[model samples]
Structures are given as C-alpha cells and as structure tokens.
Target: MSRILAILQKEFLQMKRDRLTLGMVFMLPLVQLLLFGYAIQTEVKHISTVVFDQSMSIESRDLLDSFSSSGYFDITGTAKGYAEITKMIDSGKAKAGIIFPPDFAEKLRKGETAPVQVLVDASDSMVSNSAIAVANSIGLLKSQKIIMQKTGVQSLPYDIRVRPWYNPDGITAYYMVPAILGIIVTMTMVMMTSMGIVREREKGTLEQLMVTPVKSYELMIGKVIPYIALGYLQITVALLVGGVVFGVPIRGSILQLYLLTLFFITASLGIGIFISNIARNQMQAFQMSFFVFLPSIMLSGFMFPREAMPSIIQYIGNIFPLTFYLTIIRGIVLKGIGFPYLIPQVMSLLVFSVIMMTLSIIKFKKKIA
Candidate 1:
C-alpha cells in the first residue's frame, strides 16, 4: 500500500509540474462539453422552402399559410415552375418545395381530394425527415378540419394520442449533454493514460520503476487512482455546466450515478493501459486510442441511435465501454431510472471492467523490454 501510495504521489507531482497537461486535463473537457452541448442540434427548424402555386387562389394561399405558420417551413420565395424549384433545391437555396396543381382550387370546391406535392431535398436526412413529417402533419390537419366542418363531427374515431417521454419538447441538450460527459471521461482515460505511459517509456522513466519491489497490480492501481479522481472532477464540472447552462435534469439518484460510473471509468482505463502495453511509441498509442475513440463516437449511439443500426453494427458497438455508460448516464440523468432498472447496463460495464483489468494486468510488463 505504501509503495502504491509512493507511486501515486510521484504521479501527482509529475502531473502538477506539467502545466500544459494540467490545463488540458481541466480545459479540454470543459470546452468540448460547452461546444458540443451548444452546437449539436437535432431538431431542424426554419427550412428554406420554395412554393410553386399554380392555382393562385384563396384556397391554395390558405394551405400555404398553414405550412408557413407552423414555424418549421420558411417560404423564402415563390417559384414559377418545377424547373425553378428543382434548381433552387439543387443549388442549396431551398431544402423543400411545395407545388399546388392547376386545379387545386377547383378540386377543393368540388369536395374532392386535393393533392399537394411536397418535394424535399434528401441530401441531409435530418432536414429532409423533419420537412417531410411536418408537411404531412400540416396536410392531415387541414384535411381533418375540412371533414369536421362538413360532417360536424367533434373528434375523429381513431385518434392516436402521442406522449413523448424523457424529452417531451425534443430538447437536444437533454439527449446530448449526458453522453458528452461519457465521451469526456473516455477521452482522458484512453488517450491521456496511454500517451502518458508511453511517453514515460520514451523518456526511460518507466524503466526506473523496474528496480523497485512494486508489483504490476500495485503500479496499475497507482496509475489508475489519480486518473479516477480526475475523471470524477471532470464529471462534476460537466454536470454543473450541463445543468446550469443547458438545463439538463439529474432526475435519478446521484449516489447511484457515481457508484455505477466507477465501473465505466475502470473499464476505460484498463483499455488505456492495455493500449499502452501494446504500443511501442506514443504515436502508436495515439493511433490506437483514436481507433477506440472514433467507434465510441459513431457506433456507440453517441451521435446516432443504436436501435436504428443493423444488428451486426450494434453488436460491434458493445465492444466499447461507452456504449454501456451512455445508457447508464442517460438513464440516470434523463429517464430518472435507478439501479433496479439499469441492471443490464451496469452488469455489462462490470463484466467489461473485470475483463479489461485482467488483460491489462497480464499485459503490463514491469521491465521496459
């Protein structure tokens, strides 16, 4: 225990002296959390829309007003023909185009189904999907009103009341901020730990410890303890910023969140130590860390939904500890669920921690060979 504490004390002193590393350790996560929390938005709004209304009647204008009033579509300009609409969409001037038929007014007056064509640029899926959904909703609402006026029915027979849970208003921060916390911890644990250890080998400092009587497990513990504290500090700052700046709610038990986060942190650090063990230089360590980090961003449901991915991709996503931690953090922070409901995610992180730590201990050679 004393030897481990000695190693721990040495690490803290070395870190303190390296002012640049200290700055990065604090500032990197803080800056990234603020930037990503503010920058990443899922709900697309104010789509640039072009309309080609051939009818030019009160009926068509009324329908167009509905689309404009919804706050999703902005009628930036009117197009004379389909060619102009297509050109506007292709040149990135407009994301959507609404076209009314020549007989749009006549069909409405004859009590027939008046079809309005909505053209959405499918280049960006997020923008296109929102445009399509909003257009459809506007059409349906208009149709429902017309039918009610004719038939005098109070409500429709089959009305599905949708209740969105967790994030009712679809606030992107509520979804993204908690996941960014996991990303921050993973970045420090995987990249910094591996690079720091590999740098020690480069500078011949790791070999100095070979003459000591310290066990491999003790050294690993020493290396991990300081980083664990740093990770928690990062989390604390992120939580404060997330709540204060973005209005993110911590609905579940704070103690449980802290307790379960240990498994995730250990799992990430084990991966870092294992990477350092395999990498011959800091460059190789960084490359390996990026290999882990990129997937944690893409495949781990950080930027995209895991359920939408193919089964094989989702299976591959499980390899990273971030995948499980995302669920845990999101559950605690947003869904307000406790340990009883988060058993699967917690157990996955626990098993991952055990496996990764065992591998790291086995792979960590005391001698610089």
Candidate 2:
C-alpha cells in the first residue's frame, strides 16, 4: 500500500512539474467543446438562397413567401435569369436556387400543373438534404392547399404526423456535446498514457523503476489514478460548458454517469498502456495512438451512423472502447437510460479494459531490456 502510494505521489509531482501537459489537460476539453459544439450542426437553417421569378404575379410571390417562411431558405437576392442563378450557385454565393417560369401563375389559374425548378448544391450532404427536403415540403403543402381551396375539402384521408423524442428541435449541440465528452476522454487517456511510459523509457528513467519494489500491477494502478482524476476533471468542464452554454439536458442520474465513466476511462487507459508497452519511443507511441484515434473518431459513430455503415465496418467499430462508451454516454445523457438497459455496453467496456490491462502487464518487463 505504501509503495503504490509513493508511486502515485511521484507521478502527481512529475505531472505538476510538466506545465505544458498540465495546461493541455485543462484546456483541451473546453476548446473542443466550444469549437465542435458550435460548428457541427446537423439541422441546417437559413440556407443562402437565390430566386428567379419571371411570373411577376401574386402567386409567384406567395410561393417565394412559402419558402422564406419555412425558415430553411433565406432569400439573399433575385437572379435575373437562369444564367445568373447558375453563376450564384457555382460561385458559392447561394446554396439553393428557385426558378419560376413566366406561365407559373397562368398554369395554376387554369388548374394545370405548374412547372418550377429548384436547384441545390449537393456538395455538402447535410446542408443539401435540409434544403431539398424543406423545399419539396413547401411545394407539396402549397399544392395541397391549392387543391383543398379548389375542391373545398377540409381534410385529407390520412394524416401522418411526426413526433421526435429526446431532442424535438433536432438541436445538434445536444447530440454532439455528450459524444464530444467521450472523444475528449479517449484522446487524452490514450495519447497521454501511451506517451508517458515511452517518455520515461527514452529518458532512461524506466531503469530506475526496475530497481524499485513496486510490482507491475501496482505501477499500473498508481500511474492510472492521476489520469482517472484528470478524466473526471475534463468531463466536468465539458459538461458545464455544454449545459450552461448549449443547454444540453442531463436526463439520467449524474451518479450513474460518473460511475459508468470509470469503466470507459480504465478501458482507454489500458489501451494506452498497451501502446506504451509496444512502442520503442515517444514518436512511435504517438503514431500508434493516432492510428487508433482516427478510427475511434471515424467508426465510433461520432461523425456517421454505424447502422448506415457496412456490416464489416460496424464489426470493426465494435472493437474500439469508444464505440461502447459513446452509446453509454449518449444513452444516459440524452435518453435517461440506466443500468439494466446499459449492462451490455458496460460489460463490453469492462471486458475490454481487463483484456488490455492484462496484456499490458504481461508485456511489461521488470528488467532492463
């Protein structure tokens, strides 16, 4: 007990002396929460739009009003012709273009189908999807209203309404901030711990540890305790920023959130220590950490849905500790789900941590190599 405590104190003291690492431990999460929280928006609004209305009639104006009132499209300016609309879109000044022909009003008056053109830049899938769906919905609703007025019908045969749960408004921050917390922990735990042992080895301090009485598991526990505290600190800062600045709701037990976080933190720390054991130098450790980091971000359903991915890719993602942690964090934070519902994910992370820690300890040599 005293040996483990001594190692723990030594690590903490060394960490305190390392100013740059200490600064990063405090600063990284806040910066990431602010940057990603504001930037990564799934529900795109106020898309820059251009209009070309040759009908010069109230009907044309009303159609434009429909698009504008939907709040998806923001009419920036009017285009003189198709050429100008094309130029605006091609030059990136507008994301969507609405073109109404001269006969648009006449066709509607005569009870004929009015042909209108909507051009969208589909380069960015998220922005383009919002523009396309809202534009089509506006046109559909307008047509339905016109039909109802002409026929004097009060209602349609079937009305299908959508009610979104959790985040009804589709606020991206609510969804992203919790996941960002998981990602922050993954980055620091893996990168920092992996580099720590490598740096010790590079500086020949690892030899000093070989002569000490501490066992490998004791060394591992002592090294990991400080980082566990650091992990909680990062999570607290991120949650505060997310809640105060972004209004992200915490629907479940805060105790559950903190307790479950332990499994994930230890899982990530184990992976880092495993990397440290395998790496020959700090540069190698960083490279290995980045190699794992990229896939954790990509395959862990951070930017894309695992359901939408190929079955093989989904299987690969399941191997990453971050994948399970993302589910646990988002489930507790967003859905208010608790223990029995989360048992599978929690168990998976536990198994992962145990396996990785066992491997790291086995790989760790007590003698100078």
Regions more than 4 Å wrong, model 1: 365-369
Q: Model 1, clash count?
A: 0
State each candidate's clash count: 0, 0
> What TM-score does candidate 2 get on C-alpha atoms?
0.95
**Any idea what lDDT model 1 has?**
0.90
Residue pairs with clashing backbones, model 2:
none
- Residue 182, candidate 2: C-alpha displacement in angstroms: 0.6
RMSD of each predicted structure: 1.8, 1.8
Candidate 1, 169: how far from true, in Å? 2.0
Report how far residue 354 has shifted in candidate 2, in Å.
2.6
- Candidate 2 structure quality by residue, lDDT tens digits, 94-172: 9999999999999999999999899999998988999989988898999999889989999899989999999898888
Q: Distance from true position, residue 8, model 1, in Å? A: 2.0
